[model samples]
Target: MNISQPGLFGNQWCDAPWRLVQETITGIQSLKSDVDFMLWTGDTVPHVDSGHLSTDLNKELVRNITELMKSTFPTMPIYATFGNHDYHPKHVFPPYNNEIYNATYLIWKSWINDTSQDANFLKGGYYTVLTASGIRIVAMNSNMYYVKDTATVNLEDPADQFAWLDSVLTNASTNNEKVILTGHVPPGFTTPRAVRWMTEAFNKKFIEIVLRHSSVIVAMHFGHEHHDSYRLFYNQEGTAVVSLFLAPSVTPWRFQLADGEIEPPHNPGARLVKYDRQTGKQLDIQQYYADLNKANADKKLIWSLGYNATDLYGIQDITPKSMGNLLDKMTSATNKDFKAYVNWYNTNANTSDKFPCDDACFKKMTCGVRHLDEDSFSKCLTAVSGSVSLLTFSVYSVFYAMLFVAIYKLFN
Candidate 1:
């Protein structure tokens, strides 16, 4: 979601390379022939200096991006949610942020369809849109679940969103309507390396909500990790409930690992997801990434498909059992090739072989696997650690605190 300060990268880590954003929009428009709609999971503002940005500036950024998307695909419906950087004085997105919510709501008015849901969107950037085919699309403001200072937050409102979600899903189930939920932050940690985005407590609750409604939920989507990845939510019996796709961003930013390792610059990426129009089941996700190096050389900009969900991950179907089984195998250390594929698909940096992914980099990709089946997954990680640097226990402790301090200061 980050496309800020076009042409400005400066020296900041993970700053979205804004110069390529226009090209990204062009690439997205080219997908109109294939995709039915777009799900933009938040963060239109730059992460760099986010806390210092005024509310007006943030609004302008959101407006500009929205206008561009509409112009690019005027006929296709585009739905969005709030990213942490979308709010000014960054990450302060309570339901009471009336002015901020009102301004942003108008930008997405036409695409949202249901006028009756505007009040809910205004109160908290969450709403439901029922399609002409009776499929329910629930958009959530998941930024509230991220690591933040709880003292400044509205304690009751965060829980209120979950209650509201319970009611929405219950109604959707009663009507026998298939549902697809979309949001910014995914419901689990980005990696078992450590909790990267949402608090552990909130993440568990979010997963429980998804599991309770898994029977009726067709699929779920998220953004914010910027890297291409997916989460397999499973029940106590190790059966997968749903596989949440975390669509990569159209902004190239650096990713830092827990071991003080800074990854090479990632190429900006986007996803073209196809779903069955009637049943609301996701068929596959086509990942497209822009090569910044080639674009800068006056070469024609190319947005190539990295891979499709089915071809890449080898899941037989969308059902929980099939996907959970696929994830269990992928996380196993014995499958070195799959680990390497994830490293490559995660970003454009892997394109030139300038910096090959090492053991530590590969571990971060598998860390999310534990969420799928902890008992067996722990055994897999233990075996994998024997061949990789799996950082010392003390280092993990310090890394967690260090990341919190770094992100808190950056977003403050």
Candidate 2:
């Protein structure tokens, strides 16, 4: 579950109602029979407004969420990564030497429960845990390389953790153990409108290290886009190296692009990933979502599988090459495959139905496609706007202006 702070009782921009939080916890608790453990990729705080949310409040939110997880699955082990919004001052995450790290350390140390890991988590908010199945789980503080705010980041050692990762993978490989990596920001093109958060330079070195040990590193999991998506990376020989799964968010935060009008709210969702116990390769991924609108109307929580990896993308084993091929089909295919891509992206159940892919929404999904060429991106821009506009000229103008700015940023 990609958990975030309950969007309530604060000066936050958009938050999930308290009732939704309760419903989400109850829904997960009911699935304990099917789930063995939880992969909680971060964003523990709500999207706050301008004012400084007190440290006490921030820690309280983390504590509350931690307690909720413990209550939901008393014996389940949860591996989590911190999201960009999980820090103080919104996107600004202070380094380990600061009070922020100390505060966060106190909250997470008890949950993480390893003295060695506590030391590492304090230094860089990253650590590695060896599961009983001999699988290595690397929890990374990927926000360290985030581009939005660099000052709060300890530039002196920004990419040091990647070096740490290399060492971890080397040891895991030597021990004949399979590895799973978890982080908040994925390596590349998380969304088309903006470049990936981990600077290309860092991502390059990170991928190089990953390819060097791809045999042991079986799968990667991440959550930040708040949408169901996947990313692929290839080695120098153009062979598939790694694949990352982007988990859907639990918060029903209203969807907006800065000053743009809010689109339809995303349904709250989570995933259950199954793996080949012996090989550590992913067997399948099952995504489940609750219709927030329907839940609100009926005052009853309902959850169901949105889809599985194999049925949606047509791949038995998740590899970077397989995901890349799927992306090609999504960008070029004209019939059911294309429609499926768009509908699954929108989280719409019916492909024939008029799904919401407004100018702002459509570009985001297109841009997120891995290795998307400029010409194809331009075609996507045109196709989205081809539909007749019901919005006024003023709104249309603003949309175009934003689109122009987005294109400018994409190129420059």
Candidate 3:
């Protein structure tokens, strides 16, 4: 967990230095040795202009990462999905197998250890593996549903993934097997802005499928947000049924939004999850991170525990009901618990002063988690957006009224 004068893990506010990746893998090995598998949600390539990248470059990037991963943990199973940037053009994934998918499947096929997954992965960049423990891992190509993706914008069920997903979940249920769903792009809205990640139609369908099969889904894990967050999915009955965990990026790069404002930078982070192999349930999550500033100053990269889900948040378990209660508690962005969530949102990045997270931000995030459906999300915001209590509002009204009277009297 220590680097030399060798201490600098690269720019804290920009793309990660290569050594950081190595350190992250090493850190994980040291921190948690019992890891059975890895769910890698894509974006193996660095974020750069298209002119600076191409099909060949994309394949190269994926190959390099895949090689490193294979060599590092030769025996462990690793499942991956494509991000918007994983392709040559960066945001267009056609339903058919193209050059990028072909090369990617070849590079990553061995990781699955199941030749049965080849057709799906090569066809539309998705596949599922039935693990030895009877737990099915569904690696979804969510990039096809991304807003920036143009290839399948007009097509319904572009890759027929929804149909495939429903069938998979149904089969898993029939076999009395649980599933761990992994994808790159998540459904629902973004945390930075209350924007949907997928098109309304696609997002709606995705949410519908999950809610339909909520009982069989052990957990849904996604990346691409580049921030640590979680979404709690609800059943048709409006009960919290599942939880989606979004792990922070290994890169500490701070991205600027379309509004041209640079996001608050966070330290590079990873998580060690304790789960049930038999039930495929995520029991706990231990977030670990390296302070970029501290590492550079101390002349060593040190990965330390950021927070424990059950310990810091006081959630009994990582179940959706427990997490739903936690979400309710964090609705007010100003609470101590919510403040800690903000801190870890960027892996302890100090944005509390320069980039203040007000009540509106909290509402958007919590609502997004509460309701994956777009309509419900918007309604949730409307129903629960007052940062000030009713009593406080009344007090302010009274004070303003008295001040207005005094000012009027003085003026008259």
Candidate 4:
């Protein structure tokens, strides 16, 4: 739910009470008939003061939502995991002095007992639920291993997590049960940067384990990216090991990027995933975006379920020409550069006409120019040098004039 924001006490649009009641009801109603189990992909509580009321409020909200669901679907089960924001970093140790953690755990335990009939539930954020169709859903807490030391948060993929995961996957595979794994973080970095770099060794190991039982592992659903997206990863065994499904944020946090694209206060939404029990195949997955203008909008009753694979498609190949080629194909015409192509592509690709590039000319050169020809590459360097020389001389002339004025003033 991307539960963030401090105003959870009131039932206003911007407050927790309103969002909770609205989203919970909306989610329940959306999947009332088709879904066998309702799985929450983490971030259940908004990260606020690590106190009893703060934690209790979140728990109460969940409890209320669970009761609401039960009233309709008499015996349906709801499962959840812990997000990094749910508990303070220091709560996971021998020195665990945090009252909030204890309180939160107690609240969760009570809720589980009250709401679910599942026997395999554990205290920590890891559990397995068997569906009526015999499909197993394994939910794990990826947030427990992270530690904040000084300025940086160290996210060491816990060895215990891997061991537990391995056992679960092995059991699922051996039992011939189709498994759907859930977590908060995506496997690797979608954005190429330092801070976002995840544990490569752990990611590879996890993927390898999943691949080993690829035949039974259908999909891995997660959140935290706050974007509706998906990626297909193939393993060495020639099996499409896992289909990563990221549900969109329930709150409006970020915006869609391409030009003319809808900016902030984006359409908040969630996903409805449908799986075929017989084939272990995902039949149809729909993304439902909220319509703000409607009454009880947060209830998501006035929303639309668009059938697009955007929630599952990973980062596109942004390599210039490939992007340009896509643009050309779409319009059945050639563009001079990547920017122009992207601009054109964005306009024609979706209902929103947004251009991703600002400098079409530069993108064109970067996309079209190759270093294969030594002479051409050298000539391009010379031209760049000439431009630099002209700019350098212009700057020098201004500096010289300033220096002369300063010298004259000093002499006078």
Top lDDT hit: 3
Candidates' lDDT values, in order?
A: 0.63, 0.60, 0.74, 0.43
Candidate 3 residue lDDT tens string, 221-340: 888877888888877676789898888887776676768767677777777766676677767788888888777677678889888889989988788888877876774778877787
What are the per-residue Cα lDDT tens digits for candidate 4 across 1-412? 2334323322112323444345434554654354555566655444333553344454554455445545754554555555554544322321122444344445344334433423223334555667666677777665543333211224333425567677878888788887877766556433211122234454555656766666777677777554444444444432234566556655433334345433223334555665666544554455555443342434334456543332332213222223223323322113233333233222122323332333333322222222112232234334542332111001110000000000001111
lDDT for model 4: 0.43
Show where candidate 3 strays beyond 4 Å.
Answer: 1-7, 351-355, 384-412
Please provide, for model 2 over 96-144, each residue's C-alpha lDDT reduced to its tens digit, 9 standing for 90 to 100.
Answer: 5556566667766655677887667777778898765656889888887
Q: How many residue pairs collide in each prediction?
A: 0, 2, 2, 8
User: In order, what is each prediction's RMSD in angstroms?
Assistant: 8.5, 10.8, 13.3, 17.6
Q: In terms of lDDT, which candidate is stronger, 1 or 2?
A: 1
User: Where does candidate 3 clash, by residue pair?
Assistant: 3-301, 4-7
Expressed as tens digits, the lDDT of each residue in 98-179 for candidate 1 is: 7889998888989898899887888888889986556688989888877662522436447368898989999998998888
Candidate 2 whole-model C-alpha lDDT, 0 to 1? 0.60
TM-score for each predicted model, relative to the true structure: 0.82, 0.79, 0.89, 0.59
Question: Residue 143 in candidate 2 has what lDDT?
Answer: 80
Better TM-score candidate (2, 3): 3
